[model samples]
Target: MLVLGLQGSPRRKSNTFILLDRFLQEARTKGCQTFMLEVCRKQILPCKELVICEKNGECPLLDDMHDQIYTLLRRADVVVMATPIFFYNVPAQLKALIDRTQTLWARKYRLALTDPKRSFRKGFVLAQGATRGKNLFEGLQLTTKYFFDAIGATPAGNLYYWKIEKPGDMAAHPTFSEDVRKAAADLLDPLVRRRRVLFVDRDGAGLAPMAWAFCQIHAGDRIDADFAGIAPAGTLRPFLETAMTAKGIDMGFFRPQSINELAPSFSPQQVVALGADVMETVASRFEKDPVEMTCWELPTFDTQDSEQISRLCKAIEEKVQESFGMA
Candidate 1:
């Protein structure tokens, strides 16, 4: 799992940063890949209300928001936003980043596209306030809830600290270490509990991605479905997106991965190979403990023919349903 932390403090060494850094460190110890983006240091500009995102599902702004942030938001399994309460809300720089997520909201709500990981992605908040006001976190929590929806992540947890202002104030709080440990466990344990299933193909250009998507669409709650190729083609096959779109599924965010690249980190409880070549490759390469493997027969077809593509999708969906029980 990937845990992405958005540090919202303008000062790099502020109490907000310290709290976020410690939380991310705990996540790393749990075998998670963690990344922290200092939002105040980035070149993220405020949303200009261009309406281009609502109309075309694309942001016209040519900055870091377009280049990198959008992909990170979409790919992250867990997103943690750490901020100091500025007038009961968030800092302007962090608010700008939230505003830019309007593009992501537009993509999902207006264009009706679905991110494959949307179903399981989680969002969290960590906030600190200088005052002991009763409503210290009210506005922040409300805005964050909507922000989580816009990004396709369910609001999982919020850790709020009051009367914390100075540089080292947060660290001096009672239960600082215990709170971080418990919160990290509560957020991450359930994610790792799901059954892991992997789908493999010759190139991951077509068959494996299709099977992976179908498995998720049908049984995402019970299975964590992953797809890769023996020798990745580095992209999806032609007509793959169109085939998925016809079934009301979006394949725009899907990317081909290599088994050799993912095997080092991901160990699957179940493996499904599209052909004998892929099965052989997986058997020889995967050194993980006790995995169940199954091979599916592949049929020759012309990629240009729509009918052939439709049949292939149906075949893959049936196989997925048979292997992993239908939702």
Candidate 2:
């Protein structure tokens, strides 16, 4: 799984950073690819309240945060936001990032864009405080809850430590290591042990996302399906979004991602290529793995005909059923 950690502490090597690093390290040890974003260091512009996101479902600001962090949040299977309790709340830098997620919220709420990936992704918080107050983490928790919602993650859980002020104080906490390990295991065990997983190797814009949606509908909870491309287009194809809407699968928040970004997160018992090109790509990359790889010939966007899309969807559904041992 790809775990994105947001380090909210301003001080370099602070207690919050130490705790988050431990958690991410444990996640990596459990075979998860991890990334950490230092909020204080990044040039994340605070939300200007432009309201463009609410209107058109896109943030107007064009900066590092929009270009980098937005994509990271979309790609991660799990997101971790770590902060030091500041005046009974999170740090200013972290809060600014959280505020900017209002754009995502507007997209989902106003535009009715349902991100299928959100159904499976999880979010967590790691917090540390200098004093042990009964409500020390309350404000942070509320902010994180809404923030997670904005980013399409379910609030999975959090790790909060109190009375830790020194730079290396977290390292000395007796249960710190154990807590981190357990947290990682708890987050990964269910995902890793899934009975079935599906991988797609195109831009995940049209064929891949549509195929994933079909599997979700037909197989229900019996299988877990995921989609990624080798060289992602960074957004879904407009026509595919319209086509999927006809089948009742909302595709508004779909984002393209590379197979390299997703490979570490999932171990698919079977990998299905949407086309011949995809098959060749996966074969070259995962030739040594024992996983079964197959190809389904789906028409490309060049066809652009509804009849062809319907035929391809039918073919994809048939193959998916066969792969799941249901056919």
Candidate 3:
């Protein structure tokens, strides 16, 4: 599982960051790949109310936020926003990024495009405040609810603390560390036991995501599959997305990720390598007691025709069913 943490505290090493770091560390210990984006340090411009995203399913903005942060939110299985309460709400920078995701909201409701990641992804909040106002966390929670909805995640839970005025106040809290450890375990245990991991390559982009969808659709209760590439690409090929959409799998939120970061978390019982290149890469990276590795000569969306992609997806689905002992 991948967890993306948005650290919204302007003060580095503040209580909020410390709490978020601890939470992420705990998540990592439970075999989650964690990424933290310091929102205060990034240049995230407020939404300009440009409706281009509503029409084309993309924002017109050409900034770091669009290029870097947008895809990160889409790819994460779990998203955590950690912020020190600023006037009972989130920091302006993080709020701005939240507003920009109107594009995703539009895509889902207006254009009838569903992000497949939404079905299983989870979201949370971690906030700290010096004052003990009852409503301090209310505004942030509501905003986060809408934000998480737009980004295709369920608002699973949160961690909030009051009267944490000093830098290390959270450190002194009696149950801070223990609570975080428990929370991490709560999030990971279900995922580790139930989810099936899919390690793929750039060549398998066309096949891997489709196979994952099939597994999710047919055997989701018994299996959870994820895809990653050895030599990751910039984005999913447009035709591949189109092909998957035909099968009712939304590919709008698809993005390539490094296998190095994913492999450690998923000691897969079965590995499907789509091509010779992928087979070799997986073999070198993972050395265990010979899990079944099936190789297919499936060309990527870039090289394959429409008919080829269709045939390959069907073949991949068959192999997946066989591997899981469902066939």
How close is every model to the real structure, measured as TM-score?
Answer: 0.89, 0.85, 0.87
Tens-place lDDT digits, model 1, residues 172-197: 98887789889999998777677888
**What are the C-alpha RMSDs, in order, of all predicted structures?**
2.4, 3.1, 2.9
Clashes of 1: 0
Q: Write the per-residue lDDT of candidate 3 for residues 1-327, one digit (tens) a residue.
A: 578999998887888888899989988877677899999898888899978888878888877667788878877778998988888898798888899889888888777776766777888888889998798799888899999999988888888899998888988899988888888778767765664557476644556666766666566546667777887777776667877766656677567667776666666666767678778878777666356566667545543477877776677778777867779
> Which number leads on lDDT?
1
Q: Least lDDT summed over 10 consecutive residues: which range in candidate 2?
A: 216-225
TM-score of 3: 0.87
Off by over 4 Å in 2: 195-198, 201-205, 213-226, 230-235, 245-267, 299-327
* Candidate that scores best on TM-score: 1
Q: Which stretches of model 3 miss by more than 4 angstroms?
A: 201-204, 216-224, 258-266, 288-290, 296-327
Prediction 2 TM-score vs. true = 0.85
Q: For candidate 2, lDDT tens digit of each residue in 142-225?
A: 888889998889998988998999888988999998998898789767764555566685676777877776675565345566
**What shift in Å separates residue 104 of candidate 2 from its native position after superposition?**
1.5
* Model 1 poorest ten-residue lDDT run: 246-255
Give candidate 2's whole-model lDDT.
Answer: 0.79
The lowest-lDDT stretch of 10 consecutive residues in candidate 3 is 295-304
